[model samples]
Target chain A: MRIVLMGTGNTATVLGRLMKKCGHELLQVYGRTSSSASALASELETNFVSTPGDITDGADIYIIAVSDNAIANLAGELKLGNHLLVHTAGAVSKRVLQKASRNYGVLYPLQSLRKEMDDIPPIPFLVDGNTSEDLTLLYDFAKSISNQVAKADDELRLHYHLAAVLSNNFSNHLYTLAEEYCKAKQADFRLLLPLIQQLCLRMNRYSPSTLQTGPALRGDSATIELHLKLLEHMPGIKNLYTSITKSIQDHYRRTDN
Target chain B: MRIVLMGTGNTATVLGRLMKKCGHELLQVYGRTSSSASALASELETNFVSTPGDITDGADIYIIAVSDNAIANLAGELKLGNHLLVHTAGAVSKRVLQKASRNYGVLYPLQSLRKEMDDIPPIPFLVDGNTSEDLTLLYDFAKSISNQVAKADDELRLHYHLAAVLSNNFSNHLYTLAEEYCKAKQADFRLLLPLIQQLCLRMNRYSPSTLQTGPALRGDSATIELHLKLLEHMPGIKNLYTSITKSIQDHYRRTDN
Candidate 1:
């Protein structure tokens, strides 16, 4: 599998390394910036290309691991009529490469890729394309590296990304928020770590909603009032408290009803 | 240590079983309701006390594992004069026990306890009381069962609880929100599991803020707009999206600046 890497961002750099490790030939690394392309290409022991048209003559796959918005116009700019041009984006459609290449697809690695990561994170790879022929090609390439592979198109991929936020970004924000509360109170944030991890470990066994245990879920207005009164100084937290509790109650009763 | 269990809710059930497993003597199990007392007492292999006044004659400690609002009133109602009394609550103050007994303290297990949980969660028990002497006793008792134990008074305990909500409740809510998004789009929620666990695992190896990698955190408004637009149908989620993005931006700039 002779693959050309485009966009030397976090995902591109990490994926390039993983591909090289997995024995796939990284034909060339391409980036708008020479530094990025050179860094990644050097790491992969391959040639570096700065321009889209400068892509290696023999590459079979052009993985455009660029931003979502850039995919459409970026692919239009790239001349890869014989190569399978794909963007590693969740929101963008594979049709973006329709005019640029004979084939197109997506190879979205469903996790946060880090530039400093020594190795690739264990995450599922999601692949989809314009046609079964295109999809299978991407899937075959993805399966070369990861066993956790799934087929999902633009709509489902977009949906998965949105859900990814709640599960990863948004949930992490809550953790940060919790740390903020600890900081404001002048308490050790480390004290919350065990409980946080415990909550996470429980998700392996139970649905979070079914496992929800708190004053609001119990309909204990007495304790809820006490909690609200205590959090009077923290307006943001208060709103969060009200909304989440209400949602939990709504969901609980909805399920029961 | 011989201990009496008061109340038969989530906290009591978890702690009672944990203490029992640790080879602590169960002096008695007291509950306001006869059925609850009988049930817990039967399970704990201890006598059932019908009333708060009827708590076991002699015990090293009595854990009032009830709701926050009930603590002070229950403390006032109880007739324990010299015996050690502790309430397992976060929002409530240790002073609540001062009215009923001079030797009152807080034995807060810093984990979200649920009855369905068969195993004891590794909670960093936060123990505090009126004096350093009481704290020593409570701390010693706490250390016997939990590896992670800390001394935090009512004020500090309240702060820890808020942090717990942020890390545990709020974080889990974010996951629930993500699950909702996946369901709405007819996508699999299981896809987010590996990513979520990796974020948590990374915390064991790196700073959480340093691990933050998303469109808002990366200053990629293109991806941000795409996510926000996707969340337009969910007004509640829209507000959360706004607040969390603002928080991350503020946090990033503050740290960077």
Candidate 2:
């Protein structure tokens, strides 16, 4: 299968490498930045293009891995006739490429990517298409790159994207807050690593709600108050601490009753 | 070290196993329930005692690994004349063991433990004692079981405990919410696992704030509003989505300015 990667960000670079490794013909790499595009193209031993209009035709699949806002504009510029045009974004609709090509879809890799990653992270690729045949093709292409692949339409993908934000992005912010809080009190943030690892490992076996442990879940007012008092200086954390604790307490209370 | 485990909970079971593996004599296992105490004791090939008075006195370390609420009460009943009495609690003060023995300390393993864990997780034991001699002894005992051991006083330990709650417990609730939201929308929860694991693995290399990504951090009100609308039915998640997004936005807003 011939593939054209349209972006040089972490997702684009890593996915491009995985495609090449999986024996796909990566025909071209495109990026707004000429240097980035050339660098990725060189790494993948593929052609490079900076302008969207210069994107070569006749590839089996053309993946627009650009930012959400740029996906529509890039789709407009691409002149693919009947080639499968897919945007590798969770939030952006596959319809963004409707005008560019009759065969359009999405191939959203549902894991954060790092350019330095030596091997493909166990990325579960979510594929969708405007038509059943296109969806099958996209799913097959995704399966070639990763063992974990799923078929999700645009609306369902949006819900998943939202869930990803809550689970990955918002959760990471909590970690930031925890690290800072530990630093403020001169406690080693390293001490929290094992707890984080264990919590994640537990998710493989149990629903996270059952595994929830803390002052908030336990409704231990004394410890909760102590934590709140300790966090009085940091207003952002204070609000987060108070609100999340209330949410947990309410959850347990409502469920317990 | 001849150790007497003063509970049969997850912490007690795992820690007792680790102690035995590290060549310590698990002299006796004590718990409020005779069955539980006997069960754990048999596993570790040690004696079991249900009565507090029956708690053997000659053990070198009496580790009161009970619940936080029962720690002080259990410590009261322990009759370890001059042996070091340590409570395996992060938030509880070492002073909780003051009545139990003249030489009292803390051996708070800063990791979530489970009774069925086949291999000991990398337990970063946080040690503190009433005196330098006791602290040294407890630290050595902790070192035998885990390579990652630190000397943190009760005050510092409390802060770490709070941070642990935020990082481990609170973050896990977010995963729970994410899984539920995905399930509500008829999406597979497994799709979010890779993302969660990547976010955690990234923590080893980067501070979570710097790694933060999402609608909130980007201040994409459109996406944020869409997510909030999707979560309107679940008030608990709705509030969490709104509040955590606001917190992330505020954090970035302040830092950026």
Candidate 2 lDDT by residue in tens digits, B1-257: 98888899999999988999889998899889989988999999989999998877788888888899999888776667688888989888888788878899999989988887777888998999999999999998889989899999989999889899899888988898888888889998887887898778777777787788888877778888888888889999999888998888888888789
TM-score (all chains, Cα) for each model? 0.88, 0.98
Clashing pairs in 1: none
How accurate locally is residue A140 in candidate 1, as Cα lDDT from 0 to 100?
Answer: 90
For residues A144-254, what per-residue lDDT tens digits would candidate 2 score against the true structure?
889889999989999999999989998899999998888788888877887797778777878887888888877789998888888889989999998888888887787
TM-score of 2: 0.98
Query: Per model, how much of the real contact set is kept?
Result: 0.55, 0.83
Give each prediction's root-mean-square deviation over alpha carbons: 3.1, 1.3
lDDT of 1 by residue, A213-245 (tens): 666667878767767886798776677777767
TM-score of 1: 0.88
lDDT of 1 by residue, B108-208 (tens): 99988887877777778999978778899999999998998899987788778766766776677677777777787888887777788878876766656
Q: Residue A43 in model 2: shift from native, Å?
A: 1.1
